[model samples]
Target: MFTKKVVVAYNDTDLSNDVLDYVHEILEMHAEIELNIVYAYEHPLENPSPFQRNYDDGAPEMLAYAEQIIQKAKNRFVDLPNHVEGFVYDTGPAAAILSHAHDHHADLIVIGNRGTRGLRELVSSVSRTIQTKSHIPVLTFPKFVQEEFEEEYHK
Candidate 1:
């Protein structure tokens, strides 16, 4: 299917930036795409209550950091013709990303693979979980894979 709306699960890591690079290359080809950059922050100790919506002492700082990450990611696409937006959610990574994708009726979800080795690879990382649960297509490559491909292509 044609990709017009895409949700990018960004965490501000170098690996995450690689995913954005891939999106940038895709945007060069398809400027009609609308991009959504999302960063989900879940408190490791506290599970948010659905009704209460309470936060621990560190929640505010964590939320602020997430906002910053989203902003930085958005800035990278400033010159692009595509419509771009940023979102910071205080929720589980996979759940928050999937919710945003579903709400936006995204055609694809772009993410970064950490390239976890051995048992870690078998376990569910955020990228793997999103790929398994998302209804739409999910595109991802290992860390630095985009840069490696670009180097080869330019040669």
Candidate 2:
């Protein structure tokens, strides 16, 4: 039996669930494994005042959103026999995930790449940054585009 300590960057977006599901299936085969699922609680850089928008209090709104997202992701691993924990960090995704992995002595980091177009592509850069900065291996699930996953699988 071997052990693996994984830090999964959790998000509940449909694409995010695809990666999370993939990880869960892998962990099921392990005799000993621990999952540290983390969600980076980030407020938009352009939005300074949540109060001015739809938030009652900016900080709490941010935290609450993070909590909800992490909770949804956690539900996916409920049946797994391995130890699973969830966390939310009010920092950039790459920085927060890397720091938590290093501090917790995680053996690997798993993140989902939401392959977006135009302005959104900037976000995928975080995965690249984490891979470069981390001493441990980072596995990123490339976002499914169109019928690529289905087409490849059917063959």
Candidate 3:
């Protein structure tokens, strides 16, 4: 019986929806534990590290996109238990997620594996860092889980 809080790192992808479904299932089985849905954003600083800065210097546009994504997620899971809280943070995805989990004292962190392959996977520094640096348990759902869900639904 897992009693500690559970945090789900939600993006606006189908993979995120699958993770939410898994969280919902866990909630059904373990009603006592708290749950939180967190969405990460890439923040902008006047003098960001070279690697951290985006080409457009469009922090406002990025924040607007994040808000849209978060709103969609909130609407999708609107009926979650009151203990569940949704959060939006303007920090790099991996750092924001890890920090939120740590700050909230979450027992479990859940996210979707984006299924980056070959060269794509090698270039994903943030994802690799998160996997290595997280202090708490992190669970990643396979990318194909969404396809499986779609197939089941269509049948």
Candidate 4:
């Protein structure tokens, strides 16, 4: 029976899908609440090395990828019980999520427990930072639970 707005930190991951489905279920039960779906991105700093120019610019590609992800999410929840809004930011995922929640005065922040793993996990500073620094209430779902959540929602 929470009336506060909920913000979901979305990314192209199984956990993100779970967070979305959980938010959808919450919305179904609390029709007065609002939902915001956010995808965050951070561009790599320009390197001084000559080979740096050959590397793909992360911002534009990430933003495009985020848009596609958002579209897919929208299609998946086309008949959602509550209206959902999508947001894309070209900044660090944790920072963007925290900033957005503060700016929008969100009551809850939802995200996946982990997105990358092994070697990639070591490089994911944003998620780590969010987990440590965010002041708002945060809910994290494991990847396996996300799959079950999606199946339940789709069925």
Candidate 4 CA-lDDT value: 0.76
- Per-residue CA lDDT of model 3 for 40-149, tens digit only, reads 87676777677866754787888788778777766654565536777889877788888888998989888888777787776674456667889888788877855778
What Cα-based lDDT does every candidate model obtain?
A: 0.86, 0.81, 0.77, 0.76
Candidates ranked, most accurate by lDDT first = 1, 2, 3, 4
TM-score of each: 0.81, 0.78, 0.74, 0.75
Worst 10 residues of 2 by lDDT: 48-57
Tens-digit lDDT track for model 4 on 1-155?
65478888888676778778777777777777878888877665566467677555665777678899877776666676666788988777888899998999988888887556777766675565676778877777755755778899999
TM-score of 1: 0.81
Full candidate order by TM-score, most accurate first: 1, 2, 4, 3
Error of 3 at 45 (Å): 4.6
Each prediction's RMSD to truth: 5.5, 4.0, 4.9, 5.8
List candidate 4 stretches off by more than 4 Å.
44-48, 56-59, 115-128, 145-155
Clashing pairs in 3: none
- The count of residue-pair clashes in candidate 4 stands at 0
lDDT of 1 by residue, 1-155 (tens): 28889999999888888889889888878889999999988764566576545546677788788888888999999888999999888888899999999998999998888877777766758888888888999988777566878899988
User: For every model in order, what is the number of clashing pairs?
Assistant: 0, 0, 0, 0
Q: What does candidate 2's lDDT look like per residue over 34-102, in tens digits?
A: 898899866645554755565434777788888888888888888878888889998888889999999
lDDT of 3: 0.77
